[model samples]
Target: MVTDEDKVFKALADASRRQLLDKLRKKNGLTLGELCADHAMSRQAVTKHLVLLEAANLVVTVKQGREKLHYLNPVPINEIYMCWIGQFEQKRLQALHNLKQSLKENDHEQ
Candidate 1:
């Protein structure tokens, strides 16, 4: 019953994983050692989290010479916003625009 988007949401639900994503966002193309430098969790724990993040397509890796550099892939998150949040936001924004137009018309008639 669960979809890939569900997997993305599930991965993002964890604070540790979110922290990893935040770090990548601030500075992309970081190696595993660089990622592990400022974290309370063990390196193995971070590795596990990275696996899940990659499954969700939230993080991508590139082989740069001897190292595998990790980078944040924001496409999944943007898809989530467009598929979920943006639809609801559009309706609310339209209502606000309509209200503003009505108020403008009322002022013009006064």
Candidate 2:
């Protein structure tokens, strides 16, 4: 079944979309025009990417005055980490801790 994590992963598959996320991360709130300012992609292309990002819940928009301000919603990414990467991270930390203890024991024996 396709879940929200699937949507976020799909949206993040494109390099352009990743770049857009990076821009938003650097500056949390920006208008569409501001996001497209230094980018080489067309405004329409950027708009499409933003739409995908919003659909994936990675980006959120708020209408402020006449402008739609876009902001990065990091919750989805955090969820991805907690559900995916975090599992392996705990094992890796435990292994590192064991290695550190072994090294300390070896030093004491010398």
Candidate 3:
């Protein structure tokens, strides 16, 4: 099965592709021309990056008349955060809380 992590990792594998995602995240929906303007690469290069992102389901394109507008699909990224960072954050917060309590106890002993 193609998991959410698989999609996220694939989408993030290329620097240009990640930059494209960042651009879409900021703008939400943008035309191809607007996305191309931010990069030194050719329009073709940007299109290629968009294709990979589309394959990963990280981006979705819609026809807005003659122009195809691209939008970031954030579900996969949210899944990654929930599965990965969410767990780590809980553990980190617990550890920090424990340390704070330990420090308070040490102060009490002094």
Candidate 4:
């Protein structure tokens, strides 16, 4: 089963999509034309990338007047960090703590 996390990872795997996300990060809300302005990709290509981003819930659209504004949603990325990356950090921290304790013990015995 393709999970929501899987979708996020897949969407983020592309460099173009990452660039789009970076653009949104720099400026919270942007229209399709704005995103395509300085980018190498065609407007249509950008639209396709945005579709994938939207599917992953990495990008959200808000209709302001006649323009559709795209915004980056940080929640999915934060969830990934908390669930996947944070667990590995805990193990590394524990190892460092153990090493510190071992060094202290050695110093006391010397």
lDDT of each: 0.91, 0.91, 0.85, 0.92
Clash count for each candidate, listed in order shown = 0, 0, 0, 0
Report the lDDT of model 2 for residue 71.
94
Q: Candidate 3: deviation at residue 55, Å?
A: 1.0
Query: Per-residue lDDT for 1-110 in model 2, tens only?
Result: 32467799999999999999999999988999999998999999999999999999999999999999999988888887787668768888889989999999999999
Tally clashing residue pairs in candidate 1: 0
lDDT of 3: 0.85
lDDT of 4 by residue, 1-110 (tens): 32478899999999999999999999989999999998999999999999999999999999999999999998889988788678768888889989999999999999
Weakest 10 consecutive residues, lDDT, candidate 4?
A: 1-10
Candidate 3 residue pairs in clash (backbone atoms < 3 Å) = none
Pairs with steric clashes in candidate 1: none
Give residue 60's error in model 1 in angstroms.
0.4
Report the CA-based lDDT of candidate 4 relative to the real structure.
0.92
For model 4 the local lDDT of residue 71 reads 97
List ranges where model 1 is wrong by over 4 Å. 1-3, 87-110
RMSD of 3: 8.8
TM-score of each: 0.75, 0.76, 0.72, 0.76
Least accurate stretch of 10 residues (summed lDDT) in model 1?
Answer: 1-10
Total clashes for model 4: 0
Off by over 4 Å in 4: 1-3, 87-110
Clashing pairs in 2: none
